[model samples]
Target: MSEAPHRDVLITGIGLVSSLGEGLDQHWAALKADGGPRPVVDRERFAPYPVHPLVQLDFDRQIPKRGDQRQMEAWQRIGTYAAGMALDNAGIKDRTDILSRTDMIVAAGGGERDIAVDSALLTDILAASDPGRLINERLSSDLRPTLFLAQLPNLLAGNISIVHKVTGSSRTFMGEESAGIDAVRTAHARVASGQSEICLVGGSYNAERLDMLLLFELGNYLWREDWLPVWQRLSRGGGLVTGSMGAFLVLESPAHAAQRGATPVARLDGVRAGRCRRGPGEATAIARRQFDELVSGLTGGERLAVFSGATGAQPATSEEQVFLTSLRHADNHIPIRAVGSIIGHGLEAQFPALVALAALAVSHGMLFAPLDDSGCEADGSAPIDRVLVTQWGHWRGEGMALVAPAG
Candidate 1:
């Protein structure tokens, strides 16, 4: 019998961090156990608002270094932590060594979370001003700098590039929640086109405060009151009320990894994405194409373990369910894991985490169950594993990834 030909673009490393914990192990454990971390709302930042269930992370404690800390923001810190983990996992001690021959694609979501110029700071400034105070006394550069570097979303990728000395095509993408998947697609294309040998792709977002939530409240994008727990009724899901963190993946050409004797972590068969018309069933149309392109990308008669982008949102998750139910031949018996329930929707930073999780499942032969929020259907008659993950209604996109059997 002839040997099966090698697939292209193998994922070599993954780094993920959320409120449940940091690193792949924490994410893996959280998923296996199905944990749902709540939001962090402090009286100081979010005056009068109580803390609810969220996936908040503290980068200060996780990354302790003044030199590395000079201009880094929370999300960037998270991204750096995950990047270090990924590089270490891949057994590449020096990023400069890899950059000499490879490319870097840092997927990012959300602007830098700098409390200095945030609403909280502005409020403090206004409160401090007294009518009797002199005009000059009311304003100072110390109070607010004209230009703050943390406001830019690309700061994470820039920091990673600076630390790694990555020269080949170092750039960042902002696709709101789809940035992570977009990063993988970009890296995959780069490797396929022989532009570079290895590509670092991932994204991060950390919402440690409730300013975003306030915005969500105003925009009416958050889940309605009925979706919130009794205690969280006052809080809205519109903004960054979840966690603060980062996740990343390393992609290398299959031939390159094999030739260098690098252990293949997982195979990335193919990736495809598209948009549909806006309307009632538009999500289904969009998702159907997304699924078809992804599944059809497979070459041989390969079995599939699907990772659905079920965000727990009523409209989105419903569409995802409809699309998954339509998969042909694959018995609904196949296990489907909704990832966002554990991590919340990393928003734009989401796809990177999803890609990393999918790679982890493929490499380890394990899938984290989807969060089991109220609206989910749990009957076993459907032939789907429908493993109710410990997490709950936190998915956001209508996409999925398949894992091929190990070599």
Candidate 2:
């Protein structure tokens, strides 16, 4: 007896909301515009620490009920809204039959902190002789049930289920960038292995919050003062300029999509992830091994484009540069684009957003222009058949994926 053939996982729909704007057409137009895509930086709002703030959106367009919108925090609302857009794009928004079986996997961080209550508590602590008691009293009284419930990371998935009616088996991952990578890897594996016919997978980030900024600042991970492109930031002591964004994708087996006459945006050929200690060159070695495995049998003649999720943070970003250099030397100079330069880093949402961009490039048959004058990016005029997405987390996690045109 012969072994069964492998199933193909197709990306049928993508929903993206970032500083560049919302949806597929908006992003494509912004990247392909004649002026080469201006970075939408909010230098005044965050002041010294520049950020890419999300454009205003009408929540009623996706989340019909005001009551539902009122309960979720900003991150949950963004993820729910993006998830609804994905279902709509997949042409199955109201199809109870299909939605009843669609699996969901979300990658997210803990809920946003209530800045007002936190500020009041901190101020009162300075005057109180018993700071510990004051803190405890405030925690017991000031934290409401709804606010406490909102802090759960899984609430993003719950909100998606409540708003979109995707009541399938749900899972959520909580590590930063690695969480996003694993979410996509798990979704792709399940559908490709026939365990699931379809899956909705992705994550979102709220970068405009002061609490998040304070956390990163404590670790000295945030970029400050001037705004520079991702690649150019290395010279100024590399640090992350986080962004507010949400990204989601609908993945399905080829046979399942065919049964419903749904068109595919691109095919997810492979997904690979790894992690290592910050010891000297371990991250690059891990990435190299994953890259070799992901593109094992591809021919040298194939046109390849690379979408790098380099967050402009210290050693990780620098190490990713080395890995990319090796790829250029090995592949005779493949075009590379540092996506964070355009949209800023989205932490948990970074990987999914890059994958969505790769799928868009594959479907459109062209790569977006270089984002900076760092000499790392080059213009590509030839049609592209495959795109490689790379992610090196600001601290740990290394991952890569291959995206190609759907047959």
* Best of the candidates, lDDT: 2
Off by over 4 Å in 2: 1-5, 144-151
> Model 1: per-residue lDDT, tens digit, 126-166?
66645335323434533333435434667776776666555
Any residue pairs clashing in model 2, and if so which?
Answer: none
| Model 2 lDDT-worst window of ten | 1-10
RMSD to true structure for each model, in Å:
6.6, 2.6
lDDT of 1: 0.55
Q: Lowest-lDDT window of 10 residues in candidate 1?
A: 384-393
**Residues 1-407 of candidate 2: C-alpha lDDT, one tens digit per residue:** 01122688999999999999999999999999996988888988777789999878898999999999999889888888889989988998988899999999999998888899988888998899999888777767886534554348899999999889899899999999999999998888889889899999999999999988998889889999678888899988999999999999999999999999999999998898888996889988888887787787688778888999999999888878878977877775488999999999998899999999999999999987788888888777678889999999998898888999998
The TM-score measured for candidate 1 stands at 0.75
Q: lDDT (CA) for every model shown? A: 0.55, 0.89
